[model samples]
Target chain A: MNKILKSIYMPILAVIIAIIIGSIIMLVTGFNPLAAYASLFIGAFGTLPNIANTLANAVPLIITGLGVAIAFNAGLFNIGAEGQYWIGAIVATWIGYSFKGLPWYIHIPFALIGAMVAAGLWGGIVPGFAKAYTGAHEVITTMMMSYVAIYFSHYLLEFGPMMEKGSVPQSPLIKDSAIIPTILRNTQLSYGIFIAIAAALFVYWLMYKTVWGYEMRAVGFNQRASKYAGMNVPLNIVLSLSLSGIFAGLAGAVQILGVQHRLYDSFTSGYGYTAIVVALLAKNNPIGVVFSALLFAALGTGSQYMQLNAQVPGQLADVITGLIIFFVAADKIIEVLKSMFKKQKKEELAS
Target chain B: MKEILLNPQLWSATLAMATPLALPALGGTFSERSGVVNIAMEGIMLIAAFFAVLFAHLTGSAWLGLLGAIVVGMIVAVIFAWAAVTLTADQVILGMAINIFASGFTAYLLNTIFGFSGTPTDTPMLPNINIPVIKNIPFIGQILSGNSVIVYLMIILIFASNYFLFHTNLGLRIRAVGENPEAAETAGINVIKLRYLGVALSGLFSAIGGAYLSIGLLNSFSTDMSSGRGYIALAAMIFGKWTPFGSFGAALLFGFATALSMQLQNSAMSKNIIMMLPYILTVLALVGVGGKSVSPAADGVPYTPKK
Candidate 1:
């Protein structure tokens, strides 16, 4: 119980601090912080529809957050989640639109699986090979690859096979068979949230229960020691990245199938980048990512209402999110203060 | 393609494009050389570009705008330095946070200050400096003259940094700190001060690059105008093997690629395909130069003196 509380404490404090700072920023910018915060809360959770939209927004973040968390556990930074998400969306859309007259079960699973494989290869095998064999830093390669994927997606959507018959730069609607059914009658929320939760559990089990997880963590903890202990270090790197890619790819697939139902230029909406913050805020814990993802999703969903009702800029949400990351990333400040307080308390007791 | 390659105008365009990249690439060289991995160049450039235009617009002086950008950039760098250097936070995560902060804050400012979502049009741009004799000289002059003052400054900075980093005593100490902080500390060098200096210079140079993007390359500031040039500059820094001249050369190469694509805008080739050239080249460059480019020995590792 103590361990669980310890794990939850810092993130809760970080969120509170972030919101306070965000409120200060809003106040400084001439917006009513109380009104903005109240409206933001109301917009996110006051109504069933609002809650549904927030959950829908969170589904992708949770999945992508899990992706980043898994990679972090293996000591690999998978910054290419953006690109991997795009590739997955592209593949899923391609398969979604190409097939006809297929059963929903077969068609949906096929498209989603295809997305996972393609994105896994792009996010995992390609960069993994470079890092393992050529000693190229994955950080640089993954980031560069994201640009490649971005432009490539643009090219495909604008001029290639995915382009709709009209002038707009987007794909035709996916077949109904491939669409993930909405769970909420009047909102965008779908069964994808369940999939995300299941995936989180799977990740938890993989990280804590599996031998491969042990080897991967060992390599992450100390590559030299792991190699000395007869583990295949390079193979673990490849597997860990591949596993990370699968989750991010699934995020793309779910988002497209459940929400957008079409492919378009730059359609992933920076979920890949935002997932980094989600993973960090969650301290790279798969289970923790779900809650963090919901928090961010609430902020995102609430910001639109804040803009319309509170007369604040929608971009305020992003600023708040960034502040959250800043305070969280500099968490050593909190740790140091805590230790000082503990020492002082101990001294007083001794006296 | 041949005509585009042969056009003398292409060289000038390439130089103009390359100038923005070279400044930040050199800045990355300085910071990384001092053992601070600065992936926050993107964010820093964005903030500088935004503030440069804002100050220039408010004060009616491009020079003051440039100064404002540099000052703001340094302040941002100090925040990063305090976190990454003093607090010993994870540098990469902090850099990422800064990038997000810059993007969000700038957009927010644009809304509140300008009251519009589009690029500000009335802002003044920096004047071009056409060297009189050089402007009339020929193809060489055409390639080198009639650009913004920042372009000329960037070229001069390359040489200046090359000299400063390799030949100066301060440069030696900085390198010593980057290569081995404990040794440098033992030698009585103020490793923290040198690092602070290195990172500050990086912010200044990247801010110049950002200012160039707003007032030099384009006439006004738009959202995300820096695009991915900052990342490209970083790639150039790595591809150049973290040397001043090498990074300049890499930036020039990328600039030429960009110019080539611009020249091909009139061709039958798809514009999207042409747009992909520079990014594709960056990836290829990283892969081709893999295992060959070595960074500073202690790059990205926080330093703590022995107790």
Candidate 2:
């Protein structure tokens, strides 16, 4: 219980503090934070559809956050989840639209595997090998790769071979057989939620139940020690980052198959970057990612309603998200505050 | 190809594009050399760009706007420094947080202050200077004479930063602390203060880059108008091997790629493909040269002075 509480405490405190700060910003800017937050809450969970939509929004975050968390476990920062998944989406969309006759089961799995391989190669193999062989920083390489992927996606949808017959720069809609069935008709939620949950479970298993994970975590903890122990540190780095890319690619595949149904021009909902914060808030735990992703998705889904009702901009969600990351990153201040309060209480009792 | 090569406009555009990237790359050198891996140049450039437009609009002077933005950027750098250096938080995470915050805050403020239409049309912009004697020189004159004032300033800063970083006692001390904070501390050098100065300098330079985008090049602030130039600047820094002149050279190369793309916009080749040039170049450059450029030892480690 204490272990779980300790894990949960910091994130909860960070969120509360961030929200308070966000409220103060709203107040200083001459807006009523109460109304904005109230509407935001309602919009996220007021009705069945709202709840469903919130969960649906969380699906991609859960998957991407898991990817980031796994990378963190290996002491790798795969900041290019954005780019990895962009490549994945492009590949998945192409497979979904172009494949003429496969059933959903075969077609979906095929697209997913193909995307994972392509994206893993793009996001993982190059950077992983580069970092392993040459001492190149994955942070820089991954980030650069992301831009390359983003611009390449635009090329495909806008003017490249993937562009459909219309004047608008949108690809053709994925075939009906490729679409992941929604849980309920007319609802945004899909079985992709299950995929996200499964991915989390799979990550938990990989990290805790397997020797591969043990070695990977060991490498992350101390590379020199791991190397001394005869573990292939370089290979682990490549494997860990590649797995992270696979998960990122999986996220793109799921989103394409489930929610979007087609690739839009430069379709970035920023799930990639936000996944970093989600993983951070979760302390890089796979199970914790689910809840963290949900919390962020709530903020995201609710932002529109808050905008409509409270005359607040939807961008406030990003602000709140940023603040949460800040609080989390500088969490030493929280410990100081907590200890300071304890000292005060001790003095008060003595008095 | 001949027509494109002959155009002085392309050369000028290369310098113009290079200014924003070079400034940030140069700024990143100071921070990294002082042992802080500052990925926050992207965020700094963004926030500074927004504030530059806001202050310029309010004061009716672009120069005042630039001043206001520098103060704002320095303030942000101080906050970042507090997190990275004082609190010893993860510098990468702190930098990412600042970038996200800058993006959100700028977008929110832009909407609140400027409305949906965007920044005021009459918002002041830094003037393009036409050097009197230089304007008369042939092709070289056209490329160098007519450009934003900040472009010239960036060139001057490159040289100044070189002299400050390589040829000065302060520079040596900063490098010493970065390479070995404990050793520097044992020698009675204040590591924390120097680190703060390095980070603050980064903020100053990044602010210039951000302002170059919103005011120096364009007259208005748009959402994420700095785009990924800050990241590109980061690539430039690494490619240049973390030296001021090297970063400037890398930035010039990237800027030339961008200029080439701009020139190619008229050609039959797709525009989106052209846009990928700089990013692709960055990836290739890192692969080719990034391995050889070793970072300062203890570059990202948080220093806690032993009592």
Best by lDDT: 2
lDDT of 2 by residue, A158-194 (tens): 6667888977877899998899989966768999999
Clashing pairs in 2: none
Measured as a fraction from 0 to 1, the native contacts recovered by model 1 come to 0.57
Model 1 error, position B15 (Å): 1.9
lDDT by residue (B146-183, candidate 1, tens digit) is 89999989989999999999999999888988899999
- Assess each model's interface with DockQ, reporting 2 decimals per model: 0.60, 0.69
Chain A: TM-score in each model: 0.94, 0.96
Top DockQ: which candidate number? Answer: 2
* Steric clash pairs (candidate 1): none
**Per-model TM values vs. the true structure:** 0.95, 0.97
lDDT (tens digit, per residue) of candidate 2 on B1-307:
8988999999999999899999999999999999999998899999999999999999999999999889999999999999999999999998999888888899989988888899999999999999999999999999999899999999999999999999999999999988999999999999999999999999999999999888999889998887878788888888888899999998998888888887877542355566666666666666674456677887888999875
TM-score of chain B of each: 0.94, 0.96
Count clashing residue pairs per candidate.
0, 0
